[model samples]
Target chain A: MAVLTDEQTMLRDMAREWAGNESPVGAWRKVRDAGEAAGFDAAAFGTMAEMGWTGIIIPEAQGGSDFGWLSLGLVIEELGKTMTASPLAASAAAASAILLGGSDEQKMAYLPRIASGELVATLAVDEGPRHDPANTAASVSDGKLSGTKAFVAEGDSAGLFVVAATDGLYLVEAGEGVSVSRRHAVDFRSHAEIVFDGARAAKLAEGGTGLLDAVLDRAAVLASAEMLGMAGQSFDTTLAYLKQRVQFGQVLATFQALQHRMATLFSEIELMRSAVEAGLTAIDRGGDTRAAASLAKAKANEVGHLMSRELIQLHGGIGMTDEYDAGFYLKRMRVLEQMWGNAAYHRERFARLSGF
Target chain B: MATLADPVAETAVDAFRDEVRAFLAANFPPSLKGKDNAMSAVEGPTAETPEQAAWRKAMGAKGWGVPTWPSAYGGGGLSREQAKILAEEMARAGAWNPIGGMGVMMFGPTLLEYGSEEQKLEHIPAIARGEVRWCQGYSEPNAGSDLANLQCFAEDRGDHYVVNGQKTWTSGGQWADKCFCLVRTDKNQKQGGITFLLIDMDSPGVEVKPIRMISGMSPFCETFFTDVKVPKTNRVGEEGQGWTIGKRLLQHERTNLSGGGSAFRMAGPSLADMAKHYAGVDGEGRIADAELRARIAKWEMDWRVFQLTALRVLAESKAVGGVSEVSSILKTVGTKLGQERAELIIEIRGMQGLGWEGEGYGEDELHSVRAWLFGKATTIYGGSTEVQNNVIAKRILGMLDHQ
Candidate 1:
């Protein structure tokens, strides 16, 4: 972990305690059983906002504490441990778009509501199966926007959409020409396919052409933080199981083969922690977010994939049962691995940014 | 205004940079620009030219060579920020620290931790001045991986210990002025039987024979002692406390050998430029060979991960002081990656990378081959990768060993 200020330390501890007490994985089981279309508990998110999590990255002028990215990542990571499902990451990302590129009118209309959790906002960037922000086909002409966005996380509940267009970003309310259809992917989160046909749009005109990529970078870092949380939980759970689970009259952890493999996983997780923290720290420092984001997401994808798989295999038979929490982590790991950008995508992106 | 939390005001930092520049301008020889100190744990000390001797004396006296060490013991005693500025200024001036050896890398810190004030006053100043060379005397012929199995005995005399044993893989032993030895003080106990003793190489019964390595370098030696008398006061800590002190020193060694700090830090041109020069690049400026390009990309990304982890571990260690189990991971992965990078360099240059001791190969080319060979010992020494895994598993991950 990076060196934490007293405030950041308190925020992290609060988030951790809250997640453990109120929104454990069992809480997600309850939400799943209820079949909520948004894939998360709304009341819980309101609780998060009341605790000042929603406005962690927002400016004080805009009704937020502007605590910064690393601080926000800490809370999101804690929530991630319980598999707490919410549009917190998406909404924060959308708020970044507004803060970076939105006009004063746009900020006044949206920032306060997003900070208060009265509004659900998200960036609608990808138009295909994979995340390719550079190939965005969304177009804004006249006072309208039109495009079909694929696999938009939290789209079903989002009240405001920051749609990426060929020229720039456009703010589209979830009414009139905007329509969202829920998609139940493997992770079973609140993902949607949205189609916009001449939606009333407000162009985010300030930060220029780089704003879309920059916002996507923020979203990528957010997703990476979530993956770090999941990876850590999976690793811890698997380790505890290894100590208890017996094989041939010895605990699995006593076997040198399993022992070394767990050691390797420990190293991998440590590396992942470093990468994710560095990404968050970069954003906080206003450094090169593009490289750091790609690096972070790439390691998160690889490590998350490795860790969830190991969590299953290390547990042997009990891991395959739906009754066990390993399957949830595994499924969520797959979905998050593909969100924003996968390992291969970010690796290539990092290479390009590094000039190969 | 410099605060206690971060005492690096721009003006103060700038002034330190200026001080460093003036020091370098006066001390560093123009001919030594871009020249680096050879790995002191490996190569024997060469005779220095007059200018080189002068430069070493100036930097050693100024204590800039070991900048973060305590100034009371011939050290610069700079803060971390000031040390960093010292490094940056040196890099900008193309000068290197002339002082480094096993003493600075491993022994000094450990001794400072566990040594008596008398020992500190005796040994540390010489190390800070780069005046004396120290070699480890831990690994014996029978105690390679299971280091505590070492059988070197220190028979108790009235005022001194008569040591009799053999130690192998004593790096720079032939050139060292002193050896920090681990000897058996009690036969009844295994780890507790060991004692940390300081032995002078010039003692009558001490002998060192250089062992030639696969890299065609005799960097390591077999050291033997036959009733060598070491003063009782030379023993560090308690007699049975040797294992603890020795292990603590190994921790220092492990951290230093973990690539970013030292041992495997390769300073030269980048691997990509070599790839482009030797293998060629495509129209898009990517490496023309697709497989090689992918492999290079993987190595590069992994290398970046290691670097980020290094930075994280540094921050973490600073926040919660002391080295972490992550340092074990750093040693394991970092050494392996350093070897991988060396392999990549060889593959990039192909035949030019395999030269022995002849013309047609540039100094850099020859150095890469030798470095690659010697780097194999990195994972083997300072606790092997397998041992590091056991540490991570048994200690960090709380995996129990089979009884």
Candidate 2:
């Protein structure tokens, strides 16, 4: 493991403790059972905000800790380990979009509220079932926004939506002329399909073609980090089960075939970890964030899906049931895989970024 | 937790980088640029051209060949940061580390760790100076993966040991000046009875028979030792401790085989360029075939991720102060990536990739075919992929040994 700074270690320990104690997998199960009305635990998210996590990526002057992208990734990774359903990743990502393209006045107006957990926000980038960032049918003209955004994570809860339009990113409030209807996802998390008809919208930035791409890249890196945590947790759980569960009078792990499969998953998870860390490091160091983010997301998507499926397959019949947490991971991975950009999407993006 | 790089140290490193850049510009030969300087290919005697020999001599004399080794042992005696600077500078100049072989990669590091004062003085300097070549004698007909089952016997005489055995997959054995061998001194114990010995290849009974590979190259040999007499003083550690020493040496070998030291250089034209050349491109400059483009893109992304993982491992190793099972992980991942690249190259070339020797095929096509064949052996050698997976499962994942 890379040496973590004192602050980073402290942050990780706290996040881990909180995830285990306040919001374990059972907590998520309960939230899932409560349906879309309960959404995520607002109190737990407020606790995270109190811990200065939501402000990790925002500038200090904007009421944030300014701990950098890696710090934010560490928190998200920990939250993901327990399948904790919250708006942390979504809010932080929306904040990043604003920081990237929002004017100073805009930042002053929204960032403090986001940093304090007074507002929940998310980036509505996906317009259809497929992950296409450039083909946004949403548009803003005469200070009004129109078009529908599908698969908007935390959209049901988000007071603010950073909508990707043809021109650029536009800020739309959750009030009049805008509707957010809850969309049931396989993950049982509260995602929403949001439609805006002549909603009063303000542009975050003007004539910056790469602004939304930058925001999406940042979001992708964080999403990759979260997926890495999810994959790691699934692998660990399956490995533990393998050691305990016996078949044919021997522990499941004693079987070489199963051992090799678990080993492969371990290797892939480590690869995703390294890629996610590299992406976070790139963002922190202000390097080639685009390629790094795409690489991380691509690897995470591939590994996450593989690990999720393998977890269920290795666990056998119980894994297929909705009662088992393994299904939750599979469902979560299914959503995250298609979020931001799937493997295919990022692969092509990576190719284009490489000047192919 | 470790702190970030010190500002003063960073400044010193920057200055060192400048110095290294200047030295490389002056000393690195332009003719050697883009030339293959793989240690495995050039280690043995008579393998190097006069140009390679000159480059090796220059690097060895300057002590930059083994930059991190002690100066008393004919090495640069540089710090890790300085060594990294040297490597970066050499890479920037397209200069290869001329002094590399089994000696530098496996034997040298192991000897430095376990060798006695006399052994260090005798062997370390020679290896540092790139004056002698060494080949490992570990695998046997019965001891491929189960290495401790080796039957190469060495009877301890008063002054010398009489060794009689055959070692298979002895890489570069034909030209190696010496052999770092494992011989079973006692047959009762599987591991504890083994001994590690250094033997002269010119010893009366030592013989090497080349093994023709699928690549149509004889890079390996079956080495026979028929009652060869090796001196008692040449033994590396305690007789029974050979297993430990051997494992340590394999660790070094695996690390070297993983391409950790020289990963920055692109071996040839990238997959994108190959695609553009052969598969053609669309108006948007994308590959004409969508599926091929997607596959190439996936491979390229994987390659980038592999490189990043390698860097992460390096950084983590520095902070943690030891290499974990990650060397095994790297070995598995690196070889697969290499093999995948070769596969992609062959796929991109189409019919030309199938050529062995023909008038129509270009040098790149022929080389790609050869590389593809050679790539198959990469997973088999230096611990096969399955063995590595087992190592990872047992060591890193805390799985019980199935065997």
Note the DockQ of each predicted structure: 0.62, 0.61
lDDT for each residue of candidate 2 in A170-205, tens digit (9 for 90 to 100)? 999899979988888888877789999999998987
Q: What's the C-alpha lDDT at position A130 in model 1?
A: 86
Q: What would the DockQ be for model 2?
A: 0.61
Question: Which regions of candidate 2 are displaced past 4 Å?
Answer: A1-3, B1-55, B81-95
Q: Estimate, for each residue in B165-260, the C-alpha lDDT of model 2 and write its tens digit.
A: 899999899988999999999899999999899999999999999998888877889999998999999999998889999999997887777856
The TM-score, computed over Cα atoms with residue i paired to residue i, of candidate 1 is: 0.93
Error of model 1, residue B179, in angstroms: 1.7
Best by TM-score: 2
The stretch of ten residues in a row with the least summed lDDT in candidate 1 chain B is B259-268
Each prediction's TM-score versus the true structure: 0.93, 0.93
Error of 1 at B378 (Å): 1.4
* Each prediction's number of clashing residue pairs: 0, 0
What fraction of the reference interface contacts is present in each model, in order?
Answer: 0.70, 0.72
